[model samples]
Target: MPAPPPHSPTSEEDIRWMRRALHLAEQGQGAVEPNPMVGCVIVRDGQPIAEGFHQRFGGPHAERDAVANVPAGVSLAGTTWYVTLEPCCHTGKTPPCTEAVLAARPARVVVAMRDPFPKVDGGGLQQIRAAGIDVQVGVCQEQAEDLNAPYLKRVRSGRPWVIAKWAMTLDGRIATATGNSQWISGEASRAEVHRLRGRCDAVIVGGGTAEADNPTLNARPPGPRTPTRIVVSASGRLAVDSNLVQTIDQGPVQLFASADAAGLQPLVDAGVEVIQFDSDSPSDRLAMVLDHCGAANMTNVLVEGGGDLLGGLFDLDAIDEYHVFIAPRIVGGAAAVSPLGGQGRNKISDSPVFATPQVSRCGDDVYVTARRVSESPPKSVSFNP
Candidate 1:
């Protein structure tokens, strides 16, 4: 019930090791969706002896990897172990990592933050301490949370963390007045979008985008796995010949539409999975789609929209991150669509706010990344040790 300590200062050595762990975790970015990216470092006499990071889902955890790879005959008996996230204690796809730590018999453990999942919560920390190893948590907490935001969000809420991405011209138009939006961003920025797609569990779009672009939505320069392609529409009418519909044999392609919508049989016959939601409101429809994705254990979603879909998500406050690319060219037209289109906010206070705006250049385009400031922080589980 007491308030947490006021950002306790960390030692220089501890800070260095924690940052190393974070860098290791970043290497697993594209491969560890639906699971938290964790990294571990085993230190003896203030020097690192072994290091490891979670490589992929259902693979050995960071602690296990590090402990297993400790050089033969090098003892970890009195060493300290540093990890970005708390070691898991429960048995899932692999054995509990706590067992490995206990066997190593480390003198102490340093964790950036406690695991937020209810099942593991403080249980991992408790198990470590119960074996007589000292544990210190909340070191480099903010950076660690930033790295695992998607995993924390997915575990705390049923829905995956949503990122809405798009590119527009200087005049705020994603396309010309005639809906010709191909190549709005430069080749570098488009390649960056493909990299983003490779990191998410699913890439979502509106039916209009599918019909207009007929994109493959596959991760180019592909990594471990391709993201699932999802299309949302109220009418459930999609072009049967679109690349998304025609490539069902390669990967997952799903349709989320209203129950009353018609003309979905052809997609089903073409091997597309059609899910019907009973909501008429766009906000409700978005929520239903997210719920279905969550139930299927998707941890991160990318919304590459067609204006209306992005607008609905914004109006409903459903997006967590934004990756907007601004091209150098200008195309002015009253009929051209903006990145988001819906009922405009009536008051300045009603507008959505984002924080930590990071701007970078991708060739001729300016890329901006920001996080929603209104969403509550992920829940944390802790106990005095």
Candidate 2:
């Protein structure tokens, strides 16, 4: 039929447009849960031409949309396309993006890296080159993978994304021996704390935790809306008349525990979803709860805990990440609870929590965010009530 179309990035503006395409991909964050948000920029002869990003599951994927959106009649020869993830080859919700790329018939294809999947893995790359197109890999490999980790993680393990948040003293104490913790973090840090909660699908805490702390696990953001509040009470004995458990008409409250059926029955009667499991392991229970919520794209759980729960999750290696806020004011009580050091289980290794990098900030408080260093001893919360 017609000679497809011409495509080439022939100007500095063209290259800038390509960069903007990648930036557009960032918008998928928060919006593209359970799936990694990805951006793509197609250029011909180093000029900005077309752009796209993976917005939602049923929506058009980044590379495919970008290629298809290009205006007709542009010379397809001698143009280069930059995409975050390798264009997907197999069609699921949308058609194979590789086919779209080949149809465009650009001079060169520059992708972040080969796809790490099996079904559609690297098939796009092969298909394009098979059609006589030049392909370059690893333009920004790390960033691409980082941007797509949520989708990759789900694709690999059918599990939801997870992150842990806690406030510890300078000396690493989570609570005092007396068990009085009115305010652990300052205002700025607390504001940031709620922000993390607002982003998660659920917020989790312990039963003994809810009882002792009487926490309002609701992730109240600056505005009225907040994430669902979840309490991990294995005993399932939260005070029916208690303030925290009493329905505020705010949002739904949940409890995960193994308490006496009678004690929990009342809450169930009050319209609470009680996830009664055979055991009392937070990590195990959490995985099930997250799955039940339909972790298709990306969902996160922000855990704000006291010492026992924090240590438990670490011992189990269930914690995917840790974002700790440390107020500089020294509350060096001899028996202060720690973000990680308090007691559930101990490790023989000098530092059991093998870590990647610990980023610390002390604007109003010294905040430390760390990723689980290694999987070898990746232990998770081991509290059995």
Most accurate candidate by TM-score: 1
Worst-scoring 10-residue span by lDDT in model 1: 1-10
lDDT score of model 2?
0.65
List the pairs of residues colliding in candidate 1.
Answer: none
Q: Write the per-residue lDDT of candidate 2 for residues 44-63, one digit (tens) a residue.
A: 55566777788765788888
**On a 0 to 1 TM-score scale, where does candidate 1 land against the true structure?**
0.94
The digit string of per-residue lDDT tens for model 1 on 1-385 reads 2232233335778878988998898888868777889999999988899999999988999998898789999999989899999998999999999999999988888999999887789999988887777788877777889898888888988899999999999988999999988888999999999899988889999989988888888788775667889999888857789898877776799998888778889888988899998867777888999988888888889999989999888887788999999999787889988998777688998877877799999999999999977456544424221
Taking all chains together, each candidate's TM-score versus the true structure is 0.94, 0.77
